[model samples]
Target: MMRQTRLNIRWRLTIWNALAFAFILVAFGIGVYQLLRQAHFDMLDKSLKNRLVTLEESLQEGSSVEDAIRDWVGKFGEHSDYFAFVCDGLQNTVGATATLNQVDINRLLPNLINDYGGTAHDSAFGRIRYASREVQSHGQPLRIYVLAELEHLDEELLLVRRTFLFAIPPALVLSAALSYLLAVRALSPVEKLRLKTDSISATDLHERIAIANPNDEIGHLTATINSLLARLDESFDEIKRFTADASHELRTPIAIIRSEAEMGLHNDADHSRTNKRLSSIVEECGRLTNLTSQLLALSRAESSINKSNMKPISIDRLLTEVVEALEPLA
Candidate 1:
């Protein structure tokens, strides 16, 4: 039972610790992934918004959409990774960059007016991060859509997911190892206590649990157990003294009964002396019977103190049996 209890404590402690660590690791990984993803998307949206602002400023200078596109191409060169298009209120494509030709533009932008603001998703492109705004271009209201291929961002997110997946197992393993070590350390005192307790028994109640430190919890526990052992040792000593006293009290009566009986048997010719010895033997036998009954009662009381029920003994019946045994000598 002690071994089983120890195992249960150690396992519960280790498992609970490992589980708590795992939860924290998973939560931290999720939080980091979300923050990184949000930051990436925020930067992408800001860049697209800035580009729209530049286009609006160029249009305000009385430049045509085609002229603005030409200026942008000359300044920044061609980037096939980004696509930009301008559509009039009637949904007619007025201006487009060279990158728009790389992908299925119709699939990437199903409805130029519908793909207006925020972000859009496509099976082929994964995430089409974009910014759109209504702007005045050459005395006409135009909608500008700036779209960027999210393949790079998606690749980064995938790498992050892979890193989490690979890192979690090792992190959990390390956590479990650390938890086991902590469990062992925490239960070491308990193990010592158990060993001390196991070494004690009925024959060796004088031995006590050694207290390494008197201030800690384990130390207090050991002190409590030692106090209990001290009490038990005192009780055992009392029982031994009682037993010795009972034996001493019964020995004289037993010796008198035996001696008087032997004298009566050998001096049968002297009737008066034989009768006197018989009377003395009978008196000693009564004392012996009383003493035996008192001892039995004491033993029964001690035994019954720890039991649920006490079995009553017939003292009269025991005395009758003792009298019958003495009848032969009479």
Candidate 2:
């Protein structure tokens, strides 16, 4: 039972520590993942905005939508991850609109919003983010799209996700193990208290605990226990002294009564009836004397007191006086 109690408390401490550590770790991982995602998307959006500005600049020079888009693609294609397309008001392809060779403009047209960059999903290209601008080309209204693939963004997110997935479990395991060790270390004092309490019994109240830190709660508890033991020890000593004194006083009286009763039986003037009564008195006195001795044995620890308050008395006279003061029971 003592072992079980210790284990239960230690296990609970370990569990709570591990849970707290896990919460902090998971929250931190989520925060880092979010920051990385936002940074990547912000970078993509900035590049898309820059590409749109270039396309708008080309169109402002009075070039047709197709020419502006073609020029913009030519300039950025060397180091760019963007594509350009020109479409008419009916969302139809304008001149030489093969700028996005793999991307169908119609697939992108339905998902576009006005003059702002946003994400759109497609079956072939997976996901697309684009910024659009309206331009007047030779008095014909046209729209230019600056788009980039979001597959790599997803890939980056997946990599981060994989990193957390791969790292968190082992981190949690290590955290739990460390938590268990710390719990054990911190609860060592408590374990010692348990062992001390288990070893104590009513006979041995002299044991006490000593801690290096006396200002802590455990120290206070140990002090309280020691105080209780002190009280019990004092009380037990008092009880023992009382028992020994009682037994000694009782034995003296019992021996006096038995000797007097036996002397009565030997008296020549005693009738048969008085002799029978004396025999009964002697038997009862013997029993009482044995009981008093047993009490003295049980109260083995005794202390001597100053007997200057007491005086010597004659035992035979005291016995005679006691007999004269009492009558036989019917």
TM-score per prediction, in order, is 0.80, 0.74
**Best by the TM-score measure:** 1
lDDT (Cα, tens digit) per residue for candidate 2, span 94-200: 74335455246666677776567688876767788888778887777887787788887889899999999999989889988898898888888888887897788
- Relative to the true structure, how large is the alpha-carbon lDDT of every model? 0.80, 0.74
Candidate 2, position 103, lDDT: 45
Query: Model 1 over residues 153-247: C-alpha lDDT tens digits?
Result: 89999999999999999999998998989999999999989987988999999987779999999999999999999999998997998889998
Q: Flag regions of model 2 displaced more than 4 Å.
A: 1-7, 78-80, 95-103, 113-115, 136-140, 197-204, 267-330
Model 1 error, position 186 (Å): 3.2
Poorest 10 consecutive residues by lDDT, candidate 2: 301-310
Q: Which regions of candidate 1 fall more than 4 Å away from where they truly are?
A: 1-8, 74-77, 101-103, 111-116, 201-204, 269-283, 299-330
